[model samples]
Target: MMRSIFSAIIFLVLTRVVYAIDPRWGQGCTYIDRTEQIYCFGGEPFSENSQQILVYALNITGNSVLDLSEPQWTDIPGDPNGIRPSAASRFTFTGFPGTDTFYIQGGIVCTSCNYNSGFKYSVSSNQWNQTNKNKPVVDASSALVNDILYSFGGQTSPLTGYDQSNTTYRNTVYYINAKTGADGPSVKPQNETQLPPFTWASSMVYSYVYRSLFIFGGKQLSATEVTASMSDITVVSPQTGVYSKWKNIRSTSGSLPPARWGHSTIIDSSNRTVVMFGGCNDSGKAMNDLWLFNLDDAVWSPQETTGTPPTPRCRHSVVVLGKYMLVLFGGNDGTFNSDINVALDMTTWKWTNAPTNILPSDSSPPIDFPNSSSPQGSEGINEGGDSSSNISGGAIAGIVIGSIVGEDSSSLCLRNETDI
Candidate 1:
């Protein structure tokens, strides 16, 4: 089944002009623990002029043990009378905790244009409603905490056909009320004078143990200079909607991972660590190395993961389900691909194209909600279930730095300015 899926993906890439089943790249996806579904939206399709306008859902767990190699996928349409959001790529897609609603923000609309408007979607109503205009950002990273969504640095202007001469990169931070769609006032660290770099196409994840957000590698573009990739880490505490300050944390023990952009990251609360994987390196080549960041001591350690890993690629999405399983989806590797790769057992650091683990049959989810303070204390879950699972889990969408198609028929490259 895995081989067949790969074969079909290759065939579709060669023969199909439109990507309806799985988007090419730059689409965001998040897993809904309550519904046991993964929702994806807004990506560039195979046809350069086309976009993925529909929402795609994939079932992560089933009635009993399931084969992840041939997972089930479904497409959902918005309400007929509602105004659906205009199609764009590399936008932020995140679920509002304790609700069925998801919010989407700015993205690339054309080679020279970007959309700064926001949109809200409800899974129960199957609807899409345009909200207030959001901060102008494409290829940015975001995370939701206590009903508020915070977005980090990204491109504010569309790339001028691969040239950064006229492009604008922002170091500003933006926040919004996920439930009310009300924009939060501009925020700055109360105690710090410096802010995070003007970064875009980076990966970010929130740590429950530390009560802060960790942002890693991406292109750093400023008026004075342009750095291809960076290896530093920035941590910010958005305490109850207002930020306290930003701190730079660098590894002091060992060699750090090569700086890269368009990567994916997830927090492992059980181990007090952050896991990072595959991205395009500074030399414009895709990489598949895995690295772990120890939150306790600020050290970097490389992991020799077992099993044949997915092909090296960048601009992919990754999400943690249950306690230890990390599921990875579509990415761009010179060519766009639609494939599912899994780190089936994080404790053992094993990778697989096929999975045999069975989801719990009880009414409760297999992972713990990140916002809850104690077992069975999560705010918005249904009345009764085995709410005691201690595993840390949250929705993390895949991120891309937006893409620009080369003039040639076969080449698709990252937004023409950068090497990758």
Candidate 2:
């Protein structure tokens, strides 16, 4: 009898020792280097055969060290009385540099409509306050540079259909004041200056090295044709005036990744390199391939990673920590997943355990923009050289095959689930 009790106790302890993976999708997340905490806002708790989509304004934080080595997840509930942001997905959740506050921007409400409302959450106060201004709602990718939040190339509200090109894709660039989280003056360049192609679901990263924004892999759509420019790397350098210089970087060799959307791209300040991970390819397939772009050399290199890598997915959130480790969180792989809390050590190009001694010192921005601003030399031509002409305009019909159960290729909104 004593032996049976001891065996039962051992079984219970073993089960308790297993790591926990949160199940969610379409969450807005960002990492605060100062506090070493990752904040994720509203997300849809996903499951196969689940009809009801529950979006919660739950602030999920990974405290202490999210080194991928025994990382911890905590639910920091907001004040019950404070007005919370509406439950939504594909919203922009980003943090301001040098502060403990993070902002949540426009997102799609559960009923498939988009909202332009804005709210700011204070980690220190544990409260959420609505922003004073509301901008035009969009399904765009945004990045912060010098206190300004620039949203590029996303469809505006009243989402028609995911695969439709005529009214769905946008090349409009919206500039919002990061201070008040409100719309600002037009930053769009003149018709003569190079402009980025009309695209949505693409990822954009600001490079302090060149004072430019690098965009990669989103479905580029146009009327009359559905072509995608997955091979070219578009760079938009914002200048002092309204006119920003745009250029496309083509791979001199064959190491560049194919056209994909819903991928995550982040910059490594230490080396002036951009790391890109999985996204849905043009053929409606999820990829787990990893590639690195040497910003200095203007070269693309495929990373040969070892150890257990995360499963193939898109719409996942990633943040670089310890200056070398890239930590990844929730995403979708045919189905929604919250169990992915992994890291890639860029130094060794290996998928190894997080080093306990390596605590990130620099206050890296929420989106992995390098901490330094030293000018790295440029390779492409200047302002007047329009790169938009290089884009082979056309949209691909049925570009994304829904991997989630009960979802078909024709389902809009949820098909391109947004992430940070």
* Candidate 2 displacement at residue 226 in angstroms: 4.7
Compose the digit string of candidate 2's lDDT tens values, residues 286-320: 77788776665555677788887777777766654
The Cα RMSD of model 2 versus the native structure comes to: 12.2
Model 1 agreement with the true structure over 1-420: per-residue lDDT tens digits: 563454344333323222236535676776555455667776665334434345776655444454455556666645546767666667776764445677787776554443547788877666778777654557887766555666677775543123334556665456666567777554344433445556778877665555455677877765544433335666655542222222233554356688888877765533245667878776657777887766555556777888877777777766554434544455555566545545455645677765544332334343321232332211111223222213334322222221100001111112112222
Scored by Cα lDDT, where does model 2 land?
0.51
| Superposition TM-score, candidate 1 onto the true structure | 0.72
Residue ranges of candidate 2 with Cα displaced over 4 Å: 1-21, 45-71, 112-116, 133-138, 159-168, 192-194, 224-227, 240-255, 330-333, 353-355, 362-420
- lDDT for 372 in candidate 1 is 26
TM-score to true structure, per model: 0.72, 0.70
